[model samples]
Target: MRHYFSDIFLRKAVIALSGLLMLAGGAAAREFTVNTISDEKGNARTPVISDTGLVAWQAYSLHDGDTPVHQRVDVLSAPPNTRRSDIIIWQDGKTNNLTATDTRLTGRCEQPVVGGNAVAFLAWFKNETDLGMPFTLSIPDKTDEMKQMESDYPTLFDPPKPPPVSTVEAEAGEAAPPPEPETPEAAATNGLNENLQRQMWRDSGQAADIVYYNTARGQLERLTSGNRHYCSPVVSDAGVAFQCARGWPYGYEMVAWPASATNLVQLTTNYYYVLHPDLHGNELVFQGWDGNDYEIFRYRFDTGQMEQITNNSFDDTAPVVWDGRIAWVGYPTITAEIFYWADGALRKISERTEDNTAPSIWEGQVVWQAYDDTDMEIYYFNGRRTIKLTSNTWDDLAPQIRDGLITWMSYVDNWDSEIMAFDLSDNIAVQLTNNEFEDSYPQTAGGKIVWQTIGAEGSFIQMAVPAAAP
Candidate 1:
């Protein structure tokens, strides 16, 4: 009887040890609330986490008391988020005093990117416009254009029919000779740049500008002024660079204001639909629409010259650049692929034809969203091998990588989003958040993760730590 009891006890010990081992091997995730408000109306989105466990995010008033009315999309549907939005900072598990609600009136604060000791964000100045300006489109010779149009007009037909015959320039097989050098005005009026048309919508009011927060000084400084609407401000120790939204058919252009200079310099103004810019040091890379299709472009701030990295007619966009290399998503057909550029050569990084996009780069590695499964999955490519980070049925999208660590948003059972992280070294994919509500746009650097979430009660900026170390 004693021997039988001893044998049972030994079996139980083995089972308990096995359970502990399994628990240790599994990805362990924990949460830390970075920002919460008294009203609990702060709906935060797109929080950036740094290597030192510092987090910055943009939050808008949940206005908890106000009845939720389908969340506004149109100008008339709701007030500008700027009025309710502010930037929040979280450090050492405590919400910091650094809030970007410096404006007294209703305004917006968005896309807070943390780099080193400074946090760069997007902010609207209520009635204030940006002082620095972007380059304007060169005006064409209207008088000459008017005369040409008058001469080219055909006699009106009963039904305004097409021209009876092809114009001299339109004759097939015999192409028109390229025009000789002309004045800038005449050239501007010419259709040479007709491809640079604006394809996106324009807002009624002015756009938001970039604002920099000095965490060390605890001071907020406006980096850009009323010139144009800017998006995705990438900051390095050098300074800040972003895409400025120009009027339609022109789309957005890359612009920058160096730390040494007060005036904003237009990096690209020639009409291409430049968008989705990322910068590292004095080198900048962005995707642009060259009339017929989208292509990736690289620009050097010191040299003031830009190179067309990808010339294909397919749409290549959402480029991320670092250490003079770039990666972007290229859509050849309905589906998309990943493309990378390095050392003056560009190559297809992703061979899959399914929809893949929203690429981010770290060191020399690249990460993107791949729609291989029912929901989008995260993929990582380090030039040689492509690895799938997540295989869940739910969508995992908007991946960002830094130092081989990847972070993104994923939707699970209830369809509400959660923040996830994958450490490349350990190959452990950790679900950072298992929130009942939706959490999204997580940014990870080193071992830290930050994201935004909103529920019926309110909105918030959340963080996951020790994330800064891995």
Candidate 2:
């Protein structure tokens, strides 16, 4: 008889062995001190530290209190399997509760640890009035306790490393000549090496939200600048599409730019809000308000013609296309539904129970984010069946599917938001970021994932390439 081990069992066994070894070796317990700083209003901000020396602090919300809201400071540390304690260094002002009357503020925490490794940190905030602003978390570097944790817990770390160079043939008696340089055609054909061909979009130089090729070289390009606006950006082989408000009464309009350095083209001239533009072949599909209600629309690139795909009164958004099919989120009545258009007919992908959004089509599968009892989770559409990918009680959204992988942002209760990727073929969801800071809006293309992260000064984009398989 042969005994088989499941992946769960193997992972638990490895963790158990590592813990036993660490205890037997008597590894020195590391100590961490967490410090928080608020704008001016003495609002409390959460801060966290990982064993790898990664430190991150949350940014207070602008609706919580006043801009220069009160600033409070605290320190916390504990050893492994020991009780943690917190010390308040500074405290001021009574906590406010109301939303309209209350002033929102922003704050951050900065923690440092010795030894180069990745560290994980936890933070907590106090809001006497409304639910506090959605907390943000970050990790400064992959050092200290975080590094050790990654080494000991291989399942948790997914660091990207360069692909190995292949050895070339040479004359046995002749000196080995330098390897031939890659031709442009060969580089372009290899999707992973087409970083130089990728285009970027930004609003302005100082804007917070930016979208660009994660693996592309050169200076960080701004997609949109001026005012904290713009939500999501979708890029295809021909152009880049995003939501902007340059000439609209509302704060959003679907816009696109050619792959080359061409001017932006406003796809929708509607005065109402428009969002979530996706490209399929020669058509641009998006969701927008047609003066009365939200609906799906498609614009042809060559014909300069526009058509409505969905005419329902409820809101419909998050459109994706692949293999001559269109998948999107539709509000049939009260519940949000997933629908797909194929063979001159529209079919509901889900059973019209869960609220689904952020649909992406890849390799004949439709991937989306669905709401459950606790938080949002990822789901996959396979022709006639739907499968749940994650069961954690955390908010996960903005799933981007490409090349058999699904990447998204997940928010844990005690940890900052992280960029996680799952391989559909292997059924393994691996976390690619462990920072105490927030990492959200994950977009994957050509094996690389890019997202936005909040830091000490402002927000910036972070890119991670997938590690080549052994």
Candidate 3:
């Protein structure tokens, strides 16, 4: 009886030792180095990395009473008058202020995207109408009649439209005569009111223009001029593509700077709005207005053809392109779902009832965040099957995949985000960062990850590389 009991105890000991060894091996596999790539004093945000280890971000100096606000797009704030945001580039262990030498660029540069030897961004200039002087109305004291008129028509101060021509006038061969000109006092009053209203809609008296840093030429180049609002720039080896506002009520059109082009080209003129353009090689994809909802529009520079990849009443948005494959979030029903286009056919990759959004695709792999009843979880779709990478209560958002390694910012403990990564080959998940600060917007390229970290000092750019990373 004693011999049999010893045999059973020894077998249990071996199994427990084997389990301990496996856990230690998994921990060792996740060990990596995290580095701060941007200057702490520069207050960097929106860091982007290229496949060649090139990094670019928007940096600005914050003064006293300056409240820093981080955003997925460009920073939206009334920045200090003494300083403006600029683009910073890091390459080969050295950093360069990309726009410091360009005196002509008197705007806040943001949204830097790097591809190959180019870094494209948006530079917002202060509107010419915005003088340093305080805005005031010098209208004389209102009489009782004037007060009554204002009370009767709340829009009395609005710029009035000209009266429509009568039917009799249209039937006549003579052209309809213009309305009498306004008095000087009336014109000044109307102009003041219009300017005040327009100023309210502007970005704190600023309008953006697309600009790029040509590292090959060692110079900064402005792609679009005339202070139009051009934003959401995506860079590629071919060139840059972005959306430009068509003025007035603010409709957007797709614009591109083709490879080796001296001038800008407007890709879409459908008068409808376009958003979130992704450029890869010679193919461009974006979500365009399609009467009822947004639909995917694919453009080919090689053939100069624009094809509507999706035609549905449901809204399709946030489309991303890799090689010839396209992935986007589609609202086939009331809930958002993941859809992809490949091999000249469309496929629905996700069937969740909850909202699934922010899909990133590479090769045949797709990764996105889906609301999994408990919290936002990261979901992965390989070429063959689908799998849930994370199942914790914490919210995992903005999953990006590159070279079989997926990275995202996972909100932890007290709503503070930390960067996390999962390797598809090894089927191992690892936390890339753990600190008191918030690390968000983890972008992956060539096995490297870059993100924006909000710290006590200010927001800065951080990069993480695995021990086995290429």
* lDDT leader: 3
Tell me the lDDT of model 1 at 292.
Answer: 85
Candidate 1 or 2, higher TM-score?
A: 1
- For residues 1-470, could you state the per-residue lDDT of candidate 1 as single tens digits? 01111111110010111111243465443222233321244455666766666677766553334554225433124443523566777776466635543653245567788766568877767556544333443433345644565466322111132222336426655544555664443454655431222111223355677777666667766766656667888876667788776554346777776664656777765555777777777778887777689888888777777888888768888888888888888887778888887898777877553788888887778888877746677777866767665665677778888866677777756468776666565555555555478778877775666566776655655545451223
Comparing 2 with 3 on TM-score, the higher-scoring candidate is 3
Give Cα distance to truth, residue 396, candidate 2, Å.
3.1
Q: Compared to the true structure, candidate 1 yields what TM-score?
A: 0.70
**Each prediction's RMSD to truth:** 14.0, 26.5, 14.1
State the C-alpha lDDT per candidate: 0.63, 0.50, 0.72
Question: Candidate 3's residue-wise lDDT over 229-291, tens digit each?
Answer: 668998887888888776533368888777667766777765457899988777889999975
Q: Decide which is better by lDDT, 1 or 3.
A: 3
Ranking by TM-score: 3, 1, 2
Model 2 regions lying over 4 Å from their true place: 1-237, 240-274, 435-437, 452-470
Give the total clashing residue pairs for model 2. Answer: 57
For candidate 2, the per-residue lDDT at 166 reads 33
Question: Per-prediction count of colliding residue pairs?
Answer: 23, 57, 0
Which of 2 and 3 is ahead in lDDT?
3
